[model samples]
Target: MKQYSRVTNGYTVVDDVTTRPMVRGHNFPAYSFAANFKYLYLIFATDTPRYDYATGYLSTEGKILRGLKPAR
Candidate 1:
């Protein structure tokens, strides 16, 4: 496992090996959003149109819009 330090001096860095980001971008596929929301829900409306777009390396193709309700 890779680790990093949280603090650094003028010309030195202490390898604490405990301070690290909770979420790693490489853990998820490219061009996708990964997040954790306590009250958000994935809304699926058959009658409503889904929004997806891509430009360069950014995209929302495989992701769905999350909201407070299941249908919107």
Candidate 2:
């Protein structure tokens, strides 16, 4: 298993080893109409092997977004 450190503006991150991707998006509303709220939009962009492997449940994909907060 590999470890990583990421910084976000005002969101929260949780780790799930039993799960394949390891990280996922939660609390993000599907539709909105604000630019600043754009940060609330969670997007995952992975490459071929990386994407396949991540989707295949091998490696993990780092989470990226706005409104993220550190773990307590």
Clashing pairs in 2: 10-67, 10-68, 11-67, 11-68, 11-69
lDDT of 2 by residue, 24-54 (tens): 4453332322322333232333432433332
RMSD of each: 13.0, 17.2
lDDT of each: 0.29, 0.35
Worst 10 residues of 2 by lDDT: 53-62
What's the true lDDT of residue 23 in model 2? 75
lDDT of 2: 0.35
Candidate 2 segments whose C-alpha is farther than 4 A from its true place: 1-7, 25-72
TM-score of each: 0.15, 0.17
lDDT of each residue in 1-72, candidate 1, tens digit only: 224212232121333435454332223232322321111223333233343222112113534444433336
Q: Specify the highest-lDDT model's number.
A: 2
Name the 10 consecutive residues with the lowest summed lDDT in model 1.
32-41
- Which pairs, if any, clash in model 1? none
